[model samples]
Target: MCAAYGEERASRTRINPAVLILGFKIHRSLRMQQSNKPEEQSASILRSR
Candidate 1:
């Protein structure tokens, strides 16, 4: 199903070092652009779901 495919893709991305590093870099840039609280909120939100 679509949900299974999505889960697989998400896990792949999470496991991929290159993809994870890129994602973290982007997240870091966004955190730099905005403020600390938003980044913390986003991090928590990401952890939740």
Candidate 2:
């Protein structure tokens, strides 16, 4: 029973970091998109002028 519990924990631990990394990547990309929009708008405005 202890071994099974340990195996379950190990599997969970293995999966957790991948989940965290994916979440972090998605968060970073979302932030990048948010941060980039104003710069893009300004660039377009300059081009229009």
Q: Candidate 1, residues 1-49: lDDT per residue as tens digits? A: 5444544676866477776576667667765655568777798789999
Each model's backbone clash number: 0, 0
| RMSD to truth, every model | 10.2, 12.3
- After superposition of all CA atoms, the RMSD between model 1 and the true structure is 10.2
Candidate number achieving the greatest TM-score relative to the actual structure: 2
Off by over 4 Å in 2: 1-15, 37-49
TM for candidate 2 is 0.42
Candidate 2 lDDT by residue in tens digits, 15-46:
67776576567667766666668887798789
Reference-based lDDT, residue 46, model 2? 93
